[model samples]
Target: METLKLKKLSFSARLFTRAVAALSVMIFMAACGNKGGDSAPPNTLLGITNCATCATSIPSATAIDVFSAKNATGLAQFANMQLIVSATMFTPGASSAYNLYTGPVAVQGQFIAGTTLVDPAATYGYGNSCTIPAGTYVMQSSTVGQMSLGMLQLPELISTTGVVIRMRVDQGMLYKDATTQQTRMYGSVYITSVNGVPCSSSFSDVFN
Candidate 1:
């Protein structure tokens, strides 16, 4: 009887130990430190067309630290080492070719969609791998040619005049993320103005 009792106690101890270990693993996997909600928000709408080097989607809240979301922190280095971005808008029927712009951008603070009423579809895009900082970042298009304007002849169109052939992020992450960085949000890149004249440019298939 004594031997049987000892065995039963030992088995219970082992079972408890295993349960504790499993709980610890679960905690680590979630890794949602103080960052707000229980999990990331639904803003996964992203389409990247011109990566040129990297071919992986952005890390998920579960895979990487959601807290990593910040302003254009390390964008310059990211643009140089990470991916290049391209954003395009279609022109009217039979009149204009695809209005395309490309560049590498950085921002501080991670951006979540719907958080800001400004852009809800996450139509905007960005590129690069460094931490984002709070400020503006510019990406220049290496290729810009007009099918009609005799190519290169009208440099001003794509030049500094209105800053065409470029993608710019004026303080990415329009809305600030929770200090905890727990909630995931969506974002999009739409041109606010063009040709020295502020114009709302609609965008499609924006790649970051």
Candidate 2:
């Protein structure tokens, strides 16, 4: 008889799970606050919460590089698939490869959506030699709204309109504002496109 092996979770995935656990604790604490006080629910991973208004400024590094060292191997998976991440409700910038969103995004969309197609090799100007494969990959997420395998529609995703994009669920992290204690999700995804084109892809964003 052949034995089946179970894959161990990646380091990033472990961290993501820990972050979610922390968020759950925060939510419970927020709910138990004094009734007379203005107790707003702590932000969940599902969506934004006054992100634009948050006092913390966006980091200078790309979203993928913001939290920790950039995961080159993880990044390659997204590129091989010709997918890019987008900032929530905002258009990706055209000057760079991967065009990962770095700003706060509003509700709706993948917290970001890719609006164009750039060469997969140009991501971060690393001269990636990976080729874009056929088929679709949905943006990877563990949130309730993102759990479904259905095709997500975002008119802004010109190249990836009909295609599905995949992102590593472990690459994402939940960000909590030190001042406001509000939490948000920031993670990586694949991207390919610049200035808009016909090829399909999806982009991931790192929200602060």
Candidate 3:
């Protein structure tokens, strides 16, 4: 009877020790697996241009704001990244056009080019612009063309003299995980009129 009792006591002690060890391992892994949200680097700016036909050169004194958004499951929500530009323009409105390119931007606070992870669908037009999640992205123009004169309305006129033109660009970032993938829309590059002068601005969607 004494021998049997000793064996039972030893078995219980070992079981308890194993349980404690397993719990400790689980806690350590949980800490290691944690990852905070993505972040952007410093000194980033959103660029714009004014190429209206007869509008005065975009005042070098003008200022513009840039913002970012993210979409985790559904739509875009406002993000922390923001960019500003003091002035942007180009010589010979017809020849060069007022060009504004945002400052060098990066994600993960590292400022690396082409390092931003993006969804393949967002870049190819298969995904919606309002559904991108939080991540770093690169912006570039994809197409430029003239709009039909008939499409211009007095209220919609960007310039009274300059021909109405349009430029479409692919803008956003993509991210992928081991089991899932997501794409988020940051903003769109669209032509707008600044004081009835043709110009461009980038706007972001609000993620919810």
Candidate 4:
């Protein structure tokens, strides 16, 4: 089975499971207003590789290669969504294909909610990982049961948005901050428009 990974996300979940109370308090703080802290700063992810042929270990310190790119113009409305990542979150290894780790370790990225898309040629270069649009959906996730099905399991994204799209990824490590210990995630994800139309085939992105 292909690994259905979300490097930073799964680790966040694992951390929460291990320290439910403390994590819960942190979540509460986040909900209340403390957006950034030493543990996990706001909007940071370090996308490095695509989870293909790589060492099975994470490095100690690394810079974030935040994913960025312009949205495909298939759907004109696609340009109004957001795509924000800390440009710091990442994990070490990722499978070129799906290969569940049975634990934390997956490729991931997030689309911001407010960032609008632009003609790559008009402003930034045409293919930089800096213009992924914020989609009109909820989130991207998979259940253990669905992971067994194939490289991807988007029962939720499909059921909610009624469409699917191709995705891209890169593996790397995330540096929360100098004071906080860094956790690795297969950071970097690029999404495609479904049939050149907004919502024609779409998938919600997790907050990177």
Query: Which candidate comes out best when scored by lDDT?
Result: 2
Per-residue lDDT, model 2, residue 11, is 38
Scored by CA lDDT, what does every candidate get? 0.23, 0.29, 0.25, 0.27
Residue lDDT tens for model 3, 9-94: 12257545643453444334333432432222245432333223212322342222222333333322333333222244322221
Which of the two, 1 or 4, has more TM-score? 4
Identify the runs in model 3 with alpha carbons over 4 angstroms from their true place.
Answer: 1-57, 61-66, 72-135, 140-208
Arrange candidates by TM-score, descending. 2, 4, 3, 1
The predicted structure with the larger TM-score, 2 or 3, is 2
TM-scores for the candidates: 0.19, 0.27, 0.20, 0.26
Q: Give the winner by TM-score.
A: 2
| Global Cα lDDT for candidate 2 | 0.29
Shift of residue 144 alpha carbon in model 4, Å: 8.3
Which has the better lDDT: candidate 1, or candidate 3?
Answer: 3
Q: Where does candidate 2 stray beyond 4 Å?
A: 1-14, 33-120, 123-178, 187-192, 197-208
The order by descending lDDT is 2, 4, 3, 1
Q: Pick the winner on TM-score between candidates 1 and 2.
A: 2
lDDT of 4 by residue, 90-194 (tens): 322322111211222222343233444332332323332223343543222221112220112222111124234334332221222222322212233334343
lDDT of 2 by residue, 1-208 (tens): 1101112333367656755664554345344542332213223322222233222332221122111112222222222111212334234332121122333211222312222323432453444322333333323222212111111212122222344432333244333333443333434333433323222232322222
How much is 203 displaced in model 2, in angstroms?
Answer: 6.9
Residue 97 shift from truth in candidate 2, angstroms: 35
Candidate 4's displacement at residue 187, Å, is: 3.3
Please give the lDDT score for candidate 3.
0.25
